[model samples]
Target: MQVLAAGGDLAQLTASGLFHGASYGALGAGFALILGVTTRFHFAYSLTYTFTAYAAYSLTAEAGLPFWPAALLGVLAGTVLGVLLELLVYRRVAARSGGDGMMPVFVASLGVGVAGIALLQLVWGSQSQPYYGPSIEPLRAFGASFVNLDVYQAATSVVLVLGLAAALRYTGLGRAVRATRGNPGLAAAQGIDVRTVYLVCFAAGSFIAGVCALWYGLQYTVDPAMGTRPGIYAIVVAFLAGTSASPLRVLLVGLGVGLAEAWSGLWLSLQWTQTTVFVLLVGYLVIRAAGPLLPRRLVGKGA
Candidate 1:
């Protein structure tokens, strides 16, 4: 509380907070969509979705394009890669291994992740490229300087969360997705084309992840292995959110985690910041997994 009150450096804190929040928000959304819509190959889809966006940003920013254009290109490339992977790889693997069993799919996803990272390193030359396109104008609010990029990132994240929530809550496509998630076999029997739904879900998830990558790249330099940490953190956030399929909840959780991390970094050492988040996630997951064993009234009673 004292440290926060002192607010060692408001400008740096705000900038870091916004980027971290935005990055985690994108991750949470991507993982939630994958888990909600297509449970069989969520990890594989996530890996591709994240890495493609990272790659796109690296390629475009290195080429000296504007940030928006670079971000757009990243999103497009991620969408394409996601669709291709779904059609060419996951679809075939799922078919041969029997869709009911997820082990083969999980293993395949791990393989894909390994291959993807290797390929990324090969093409991107394993070097960190500085991301420079446009400088964000600074503004003063309440006697503290704030970077425009922070506001932009925060706004974009909020907008995406709202838009996604609206689409899922009030759209026919959303209904189809829910139906598929509830019972893919039943949805297929009803002529809903479960495969197509999976494809679409993967595409959407990838697109969101691409946006995350673009924003992340814009703030920090691009590196071949950049997606690993954020991807892992996203999966953790999704798990902690209790598989609720609520983007708002996920966004809030991400932001909370971000703020907590920022505060920790301010008061503690940088090395301990990530450690604190990991501990929090572990504790949350333990409590969550134990919920089913507790009495109904005790579970989530106050939360």
Candidate 2:
């Protein structure tokens, strides 16, 4: 009877939103890890995502491998490809066009991304690749229904996020990554291989992207440009969480955003839901930017 149930019941929408949000958490956290640590904008991450999805689809549909194995192999291939991008393209540019990277990093990333997109389009064309990996039955509970893939995706995200948090909090490698993120120059001076740290971030980030690609292709269709929206959303979440935000915090923020997006469907058309989410994000950013300039209220009715 509530307004939020105009299109569907609250329970159904909430269930869907929660699962969708879990993917967002994973995507956002991965982007943040690389961007925060490596200082690379990584526009080419979309290429990695697309390639991984297609690779998995090929293995499953053409090679006759099971979905899980295909996904794992595809993720591995994508991870290697990402590391190659870092080592072959980004690192070389950083060396040649050095000076606190006035503009070269941006130019390099943009160029590589464009070139990669063109190549993919040339090879795969603009046709959407449908995934026929597995047959799934919708599961229902509490008057809500969802598929098994949703639960698997959410569980994987939660487990990985928690493991990442623990590693960042308590491990020696974590301390090194923290130090490098804080000050690469100081880290290099202290005998920390800053380049190695960057490499690690890229590998981890790309591996996450591959996992996302797997779940995404399974749930939806795959296309060369499929990564565009997810990539943009991940960047927004990373910035929304800010430089100081913990990985767990990023995941929580993503979940909250997912819920907001779902609730927004109560009033807007499905076509406009994504746009509304960005509008809301912009409003939040404006308020955050203005908050620091505003004066605080006096406590206890006294100055």
Candidate 3:
């Protein structure tokens, strides 16, 4: 409270909160596409998708390109890398398992993560590179100040989340995904191409994650290990939301967590700030894990 009241660090804290929300939203979207519903090669694709975005950002920054062009190239390269990973590595592993068990997929994702990090290190030389671009002009409105870039990034995340939710709810593609996730065999019986749906979902998730990578690069320095932290946080957020289908819920959770994290860091130390997220994750997990263990009559007899 004293630190926040001091006011000197408020702006930086606000900016960090916005960026953290965006990162969490992006990561949540990526993992949700796999664990929450899609639950297959989608996870593997996300691994590749995140890795490709990191690699592209590193390449562009190292090459001295402008931000917009670099972002464009990064997204394009990410899409291509996503496609290749899906078709080559994921397809082969899925074929071997005949899409029956999850262990093979999990192992394959680990392999992909290792390979992706190694490739990034080889190309980017394992050093953090400065991400240079136009400084965000801050504006004050209604007694609240915000960095323009943070506002823009948060707005972009909201738009993407809404667009994605709408597409999944109203579009034919969305129906196919729901069907596949609900029951692949039944979806196939109804003439839906399950494999195609899986591929498209993976691609879409990766694309969103690529956009997130660009925003992150704009806010922070690009590094080979950048995705690891965000990726873990995203997983926690997704689970905390209880596999929520609402993108709004996901966005809100991200933003709320971001605010909490920022507030904690301001009041405490930076190290405790990181620990707070894990603490929240563990607390949520315990509550969830205990839900089924409680007596049913005591759990919800009146409700």
Candidate 4:
């Protein structure tokens, strides 16, 4: 508390944390969708976002394309690639492995992530590049300030989360996903087209990734490994947020994480940012794990 009070700029740090949290929340929800429907935790998902950001950047900065066109192309490329991964790699592996295919799928995603980085290096030369886009001035209020880009990014995340929540709750496609998630065999028997659900979910998740990547690129330089850090935090947040289908919880948790990370810099070294966040993850996992165990133990004692 003292450190934070004495810190160079508390307001700026808080604002930074909020923006970072919003990004993490969106990414976490995206991962949660894939996890809930497909039962596969894709470690390589970050690569898709990073790659799309780079692709969009290259299209606009190098190929001389308009911003929206380049962004559209990049988003399409990323979504298509995500669907292809599901159809080509994960689907085949799942078919072969049957009930316990998650491990195999995870391994394949890891491989994909590595391959993505290598390909990025091969094409983009592993150098960080600036994002080309329209400039916006900073917005300030009550001694706290942020750029318009930050506001856009944060707003985009919140809107996407709400939109996803609405789609999942009120749409036919959402019903198919919920049905498929509940029991694939039953859903298939009911002619829910489970495979289609998987494909759509994966593509949707990837589309979110691409959108996030565009904003991320706008805020920071694009590089091959840019997604790794945020990816880890987002995945952890998804797990911490539990099985609730609401994105609002994820958004709150993401903000908490961002606050913790930003405030840690006041008292801890810069290198401890991730470590601090992971500690929170570890603590949450332990507490959640204990929840079920404690109930079972109480039941046993009562019996």
- Whose TM-score is greatest here? 4
Worst 10 residues of 4 by lDDT: 294-303
TM-score of each: 0.86, 0.90, 0.84, 0.92
Top lDDT model:
4
lDDT of 3 by residue, 195-278 (tens): 788677667767777777666666776677777777677777776664535666777778777877887866887767877888
| TM-score between model 3 and native | 0.84
User: Across residues 27-102, which tens digit of lDDT does each residue of candidate 1 receive?
Assistant: 7877787767777545655556557556566666567666667667778888878777778876777789774646
In model 2, the worst 10-residue window by lDDT is 294-303
Q: lDDT of each structure?
A: 0.72, 0.80, 0.69, 0.84
Q: Give the range of the ten consecutive residues with the poorest summed lDDT in model 3.
A: 41-50
After superposition on all CA atoms, what RMSD does each candidate show versus the true structure? Answer: 3.2, 3.7, 3.5, 3.3
- What does the lDDT read for residue 291 in candidate 4? 67
Task: List ranges where model 1 is wrong by over 4 Å.
Answer: 1-5, 8-15, 44-67, 140-146, 292-298, 301-303
Clashes of 1: 0
Encode model 2's per-residue lDDT on 1-303: one tens digit a residue: 225555346788788778877778878888888888888878788888888888888888888998789889999988988899889988888789866652677688778877887887787778988897667778998788899888888988877778777887899778888899898899999999999988888898898888888888888888888888878777777777764467898888778777777777776767777875688678767766666565544111111
Model 3: CA > 4 A from native:
1-15, 41-66, 98-100, 140-146, 295-303
List the candidates ranked by TM-score, beginning with the highest: 4, 2, 1, 3
